[model samples]
Target: MAPCVTEWVTSCTNLILSATALHSSYRLFKDHRAPSVGLFLLGLSAALCIVHPSGSYLTSIQKEAEWAGEVLAPALVSFDFLWLSEDHNTAHILLCGSCLLLGLCDWLSADALTVMTRCLGLSSLSCCLTVCLFAGNALGALSGVALSLPLLVAPKVGAITFAPLISPAAAEGLVKWLLKGSMAVGCWASTRALSMFLLDVTDRCNMGI
Candidate 1:
């Protein structure tokens, strides 16, 4: 059967957002050799597959591959920060390690992994936002917010169980598509937001201002 209007819209949105994010990540990678950013790019690349029109029919192996990227992207970002931080206090190191462990343990359970990754990603974004706010960089903060806000709704979109106007099966299908789209938005926004913040910091350091 042909895709309905909703599927078309959702797939288009996901494709656009994921592609934009992938571009931002590529530009950042060109300038910096940070493993975290590279991992995020990998994740975004995997995300492109999930947002495709036939995403709903992904094979089990394909789904697992996508989930692996999702789980590692945020953890790697935190790990990168820890590696770069001047003051690697015990608390900070321990926290990052703990989160990485959680992602590893949650790996087999897709739903649990999604929630964990989002929380980890949000924490990383929040740290970036705090730094941007302290530096009075309105644009960086805006990007961070753009990245974080959609994530707050993503879990809820997946959890949606009913729509009075539609049958339960249709509602479930709609929710799944919406969830994929939301995840694509999260991938795009997170990479762009994080990369912008890092770029701004790099500029300030280089200028010594």
Candidate 2:
């Protein structure tokens, strides 16, 4: 797809904070089990999004990434603060609750391979079908093979809060690395979800959902 500078730059900036956050979270992963839990959490979160009334927490996430961007993913645990559309009470609680679970799962799935391996079929299916909801899955799943590079290369400048990728001065020291990772991973998926939601289809393929 031809890239839009605004969207591209925004996506890149989001990458920086996410990479930093993942790097920090890795430290907390003791042994292999932590990663296992992380994957489970991610899987669970995805499942919840699929089953919930308003397609899970995708709405809250959509606004967060569009506005909050990077911090939205790294601070996955704090997804409670994500944006809202048309005032949804069930979605709000479910969104926060679901994000909390997904955070724990991601902490367990340390590597993308784990999720990729399990979701391989879905990933391929996502590519074949242009399900409006899974729109991002096409390139997203393919990119899963090398997710880290983008994480490192995406811009870190003009970055706002929790954007650890930005050269934060002592003033911005408040935002830690873990927060960046949480926002990155969470927001990334959230954006993808929003894409699917906006398109309004739940078929397996689009962004490799």
Model 2 residue 22 lDDT? 45
Give the deviation of candidate 2 from the true structure as CA RMSD: 18.0
Per-residue CA lDDT of model 1 for 1-209, tens digit only, reads: 13476566555655665565566566556543443363455446455554544445555545555555544444444444433333256326535643564558535476765566667657655654555566565654554444444334454543464656665555655655555555445445545555665666678779995
- Please provide, for model 2 over 1-209, each residue's C-alpha lDDT reduced to its tens digit, 9 standing for 90 to 100: 12354334444444564343344335323422222233333333332322224644775654323322221222232221122122245335434533444355435554552343234323322322333223434433322222222223223422556345444442232232333334445434433433433343334346565
State the TM-score for model 1.
0.57
- CA deviation > 4 Å runs, candidate 2: 1-3, 31-209
lDDT of 1 at 56: 53
How much is 149 displaced in model 1, in angstroms?
Answer: 5.3
- In terms of TM-score, how similar is model 2 to the real structure? 0.21
Give the runs in model 1 whose Cα sits over 4 Å from its true position.
1-7, 35-58, 68-103, 106-115, 148-162, 165-209
Report each candidate's C-alpha RMSD, comma-separated, in the order given.
5.3, 18.0
lDDT of 1 at 34: 48
